[model samples]
Target chain A: MRDRINALARLVPVWAVWLGYGWVAPWLIYRGATGGLGAEPIKALERELGEIALQLLIIGLCLTPLRRYLGVNLLRFRRAIGLLAFSYVCLHLAVWLFLDVQDAGRIWADIVKRPYVTVGMVAFVLMIPLALTSNDRAVRWLGARWRRLHRLTYAVAVLGVVHFIWLSKGFQIEPLAYLAVIFALLALRLPDSKSLERRTR
Target chain B: MANRWKNDLRARDVTPEAVYLDRRQVIAGAAGLGLVGTGRAARAKVPEPNAWEDITSYNNYYEFGTDKGDPARHAHRLTVQPWSLRIDGLVDRPGDYDFADIMARMTIEERIYRFRCVEAWSMVVPWNGFELADLLDMAGVQAGAKYVAFETVLRPEEMPGVRYPVLDWPYVEGLRLDEALHPLTIMATGIYGRDIPNQNGAPLRLVVPWKYGFKSIKSVVRITLTDTEPPTSWNKANPREYGFYSNVNPEVDHPRWSQATERRIGGGLFARREPTLMFNGYADEVAGLYAGMDLKTYF
Candidate 1:
């Protein structure tokens, strides 16, 4: 009990951040539901949530790189950041499916036919395994294979950026700028000694 | 394929053709060149000029750039001054028309039209320009001319996207000659009581609100009359994704998303998308022209 309590203590700050954001999403939904969103509100809400999801994803991806660079060892909080990212993504998908599309056939087609949505769906699927295995027991049971499986995060990161760029119908630089920052951070892992830990071990 | 889809949807009996016909007349009138003879005019009810204007001026042609608001923001880098429109192929007069001379001789007029994007949001705006027929007449199209292709300016220095081939650069769009000469088709220069901002396809742009936004070509530097369906930039890049017609119909959804509704920009969250209209509500004037034809196939 004491050990579990201590573990919970370490997770508190991350949960607070996720909870704060999650709390605000409902207020936004309420405003949207009550007709506060106005003529183009559905799209506006979807766009806002999509951006939030992207930011959360970026933040989650950043945690690992930041830990290594800063020597902060904040790996304990990575799971929370990732789960929050997934939660926001779920919200984004919900808004699109229910509020925007409102048609299951079309939504299913989008997931199947559209390259952007396909990649996004794949990234989401990959995330599920990571999220499921994030607990201590799964990590211990999976042991050596677990870290290898989680490396799929890099693939998810790349897909997330591609999804963003694809969604922007026109050639705008804002998405590109986001991609550049994420790319630079992820690229650092390519030649780093920490990434090659197995050989040294 | 487009025709089959429309026919299949028609067979579904969910959306009535009568409802679609009500709006089709306006689209035909706007798209009909002066050639839409007198017999056709009396049969179709004239649509009232559109009443809104905010959505007309703001747009994004991914062929040019990607922000929903970017075209109206970056379009100015294209210099309209000393503009020369090169007209060639299947035309009696194959030459360049200087912008100043064209503006000087053409009868310019202002018409208020509702601009509906395929995205489903819309705005009514008054635009000032000459009928495209007037320009085509100036060039004197020949008997073989079936389509008029418009080429937008390509300059990496001005249009940064040119270097990347994000799309087949120097976007190309075409219209059937009749469609090109439609009374509603305008080579516009100004909007909202002001000279069009650089971002709004300044110098000139095509305005075909009934069709998808891409049909309204921008920053055109060349016009070529051809005998065959011209290869459109978007269609060439992804033919299955973007058809030649690209008409705005909610019933026919995009492969990746539904076309049933669109968010009118500037409207807050939770707002429902307005129902999409057939031929963007101009079917009455144009439907009979394709009475025996299939729109889904052409689209």
Candidate 2:
């Protein structure tokens, strides 16, 4: 079954996956323009894009655990997943900046004054380095340093979830659920004492 | 039907059907002139009432759900017929007043007032209803009454959002006796010459124009005249975020978002947010009510 899964994963191109996922933003924009996104289309579109970006980040986080525990070696597509998440995050920020909040001074004020926006901006800023280094040349040049830099993803994911939770009015379950899943994924990555001792020996 | 007040805003002042239909063009024209965030000088003109679709579809009634569209989707289950408002506490005539009976006694009129939400979004609504003061007079407000408390209908089977504790169930709101008695305050029964849709607080709802939208509680079921301050749903949920005196003050921002500017609903995709007015542009009418009081601390 594992071999079959690996073969199936190889059959699909990473660029195809990228293109498929990339189509969502334009589709949402189309929906917004056509009045399909309901009364508050700008807010709806902004939230949907943010949610999609978070979901993509969650998917990217799952790759390591899936490969380690279940022998689902989909490591080849990790770069594509990371870059897609980054792209979606940029799109989400763009929508918020251009459509939802059109004022330049207010945008800067929000980032500085609002804690949720600050956290969201921090997460977006962190993703920039990871996205820039996703290329093969950067990976080869950075060597061991590349993996260390990419570990920033965990912090970015946690901050993203925190931002969502903080931004939501009242106590909402959806953002809390994201918080739980991200924590569990991070927990799975923790090195067991025995494994650590063995590796040191 | 009218005793004293005159309509300041007319039906023609409502957003034109042509403008509403061709909002994209208007938005583009506005954007080209860099008019999106020009500040308070540009906001002097009276706000145009949003289209019927925008007013009905976009709402913050959490009884149906938290999402803006949730009320429109789930409010169909709400049964507004055979409704009665329980008017109790410091009143001479206190009983389960039937909805139709109340309507017959009160004089309803069109009150085109600016509606601002605490979330920094706004609309101009032409509410058809009578002054709440008139209703209080009929009930015979006792001298001891200091506050007017309101409660929304709580039908778990009907209101799906009630299943979750988004707010204290049976959403409650309150106003100071003077604030409640203010001529600007009305119990709206209809919108734009039609009975309000179930999603937009059907049958009867308090419409306190100068305060935030949530202060004008929807789908009201009870109104209690009391001496002590009453607990409001949002204030109870998060006092830091929401206050008992949730007046629309542009200077006093909500903890989460800015209240200085508001996005006008139905302004199309690229529309700029206009600066919010003090007391939602009704300060001239209602400002004297809060004389010498600290709005920032109260907010």
Candidate 3:
């Protein structure tokens, strides 16, 4: 029964992403369509998608720590989590590129001029390679190099936190909380967890 | 209800986002100071404009939370019924004016103004209010008064985010005495002919159309006329990013965002970005106020 439950749980990541995209994004879009995005629906929608993407990335980063320290392995589902996070990031970028900022010409200026936009674009740039390499054939062919390359995910996580922290106007708790959580997860992967890390490898 | 306060403002005159870009350059080239004004006679009548963007209760009050949607979701916890504004400092009649009494004594008017946020978003809102100058007149400003400072209500139990140091609580904003007394500066009581929504700043708020939205402090409870500039909340939080004289300036870019263009609210995802105006297109009326002083240096 325990083994069955663990097997069932691996599918949770796949279903979770589907649920998030299928339900959450559309619900917000519907609310926006129905005049629920408040005085500035476009802005609200744009920010909301970005937030969801950031949260999913944060969740994806949590898998390693949860297994090593807490003795609960979601290792089998890490691919799903990573892919889901990538989808969200893609959606977030699409919203900004196509919807929020419609002018193709002005996009370069925003990416170049605004610090928040610059940091966010940097995050998107780091995410593109990671998203492209999220398949089994690539993972097998690359082998040890694949793990080394995938380690760039940590930088993606760092950029994600930096992007959020810089994007906010005033001092905020949410962005800081995300920073703390990401750091804590990275900290848990240090020297002491060598045995767990090797086993996971 | 929204139609009741319909003053004769051309929809194009108020929004003017799509048409404003090149038109401004032409006007600037022709007039040399960009004052080929909206060119419409200011008339008063039923507006019958589109619905008020659903006013869907979303707000961006950092004292409440940093998120744009956080304020509307959380501001309802405020207990507003028995509210009173403490009018003090540099004024003769320094006392708490109960909400009911203040409403009865004030002369209400409809002002459809172009609203701009410091974050480079813009909206055209029809605000219902009495002139802030009239309120100052009622308080009999002392000769020494140099600035009119304002503060938002701070109730920890009611305002959940106040517990966090999102900002130095009891949000404060101030305006120069002359700016405070300008006819365009108003103490808004309502919008779209309806009582101001809690998220929109219930009971009372300031509306300085020429300045960015932060200058229009929300849920105001304190009005202090002072001899010096009062510390504004955002400026105190980050001076480089937010100036006390947060008048909409396309020339002076915010450290983080471009002030050159603004996306009009409710124009959906593909809204045309309009060139931001100097003093948010109230350059005709308020530009003279800053005649000699360099806005860049002050900003």
Q: Provide the TM-score for each candidate, comma-separated.
A: 0.71, 0.93, 0.84
What value does the lDDT take at residue B51 in candidate 1? Answer: 20
Going through the candidates in order, the fraction of native interface contacts each one reproduces equals: 0.41, 0.53, 0.61
Model-by-model DockQ, in order:
0.30, 0.64, 0.42
Q: Candidate 3: lDDT over CA atoms? A: 0.77
What local lDDT does model 1 show for residue B273? 56
In model 2, what are the clashing residue pairs, if there are any?
A: none
Better of 1 and 3 by TM-score: 3
Error of 3 at A59 (Å): 2.8
Candidate 1 at residue B68, lDDT?
52
Chain B only: TM-score of model 1: 0.77
lDDT of 1 by residue, B164-211 (tens): 656777889998887887766778877644576666676788887568
Chain B superposition TM-score per model: 0.77, 0.90, 0.84
Candidate ordering by TM-score (highest first): 2, 3, 1
Model 3 Cα displacement at B296 (Å)?
Answer: 2.0
lDDT winner between 1 and 2, please give it. Answer: 2
- For each candidate, the alpha-carbon lDDT, in order, equals 0.69, 0.88, 0.77
